[model samples]
Target: MPDITLLIVDDHPVVRDGLRGMFTSAPGFEVLAEAADGREAVALATGLRPDVILMDLRMPGGNGVEAITEIIARGLPSKILVLTTYDTDSDTIPAIEAGATGYLLKDAPRDELFTAVRAAAEGRTVLSPAIASRLVDRVRAPQGSTLSAREREVLRLVAKGTGNREIAAELFISQATVKTHLTHIYEKLGVNDRAAAVAAAYDRGILG
Candidate 1:
């Protein structure tokens, strides 16, 4: 089999160096390039088209999600494997929704990282244990999300800073109906209030 070409995208030089050393030393992998942030990653990826990108989530310029989104939009062949320190829903959900092939934490073992890269190179989905459980819970949640059209309309209005009464007026529905939709939205998004719901919706791709 051909060596799996890789682009390491991370803000920390030390972390990038470590990953470079590890992957370069390992057989069946080739380190194609290194990028300091998402912008650099995208530029390098556009040119190099590596087999896999080991990407970090948070960076000074252009976050990992945006880079993943852009790369997917451009139809780049590289499979994105997010290697980040964050595992929160706020982080993992967006990266996955943005078309990452895998999500692995910084604390993952070297062997596991290598295995994940191989799987990602083949377009398989890989997620850390914690992230996998979170997705499972969301899938098994009681109110089975898959929002109705009217409910989605309410959420869009809510995201745009519209009040319940205003949403009711805009949708030609009563305030009580708006409240019901908000409650379902909160349950589906696993958030308590409006702001959290909006944020979670954006993170999970429930809303744009």
Candidate 2:
């Protein structure tokens, strides 16, 4: 496999410089580009086609969400991992909805950040442990049957953002059943994936 190329997006020079320095000593990771704002990030990402992006949630000139959306709409092959200081549910959900494959805190230890970058390169979703509980709490909340009892159960696991295989074992259902349920839930909620479904569930008052 090719070395993982990263595009760092943040408005702060210190943050960008620190990230660049970290990656400088980290193997298998390269800083392909750097941008001070979202628009610059998007433009550089488009032209450079880096393998991964370390995006900040809050930035001027379109923000990380806007960059993610633009990159996805353009069908760029790079994956996005949010690297921000914000740990609130608001920042978390929107980042996912905007097509981020991973959410990470900026203050994470160097080892964790390295691991997360490797995981993101391999197309795995990574979430900081601190915000993982919020997903679990949302799953535990009582809600109406926007989905069937079984479907609701599936969606609850989904709201917690568990992978299909994890959901299958947790629910004692086959992977096929998990996919079928996911398809139905997406159709019902007008979403396309765990991220969009989570967003829809929140927006439609299906979850807390």
- TM-scores, all candidates, are 0.71, 0.68
Name the regions of candidate 1 deviating beyond 4 angstroms: 142-208
Clashes of each: 0, 0
lDDT of 1 by residue, 19-128 (tens): 99999999999999999999999999999999999999999998999999999999999999999988766688789999999999999999999999999999999999
Q: Residues 91-184, candidate 2, lDDT per residue (tens digit)? A: 7777888799899999899999999989998899999998777656555744333467787788788888789999999999899999998876
- List ranges where model 2 is wrong by over 4 Å: 142-208
What is the lDDT for 130 in model 2? Answer: 86
Question: Cα RMSDs of all predictions?
Answer: 9.4, 13.2
Clashing pairs in 1: none
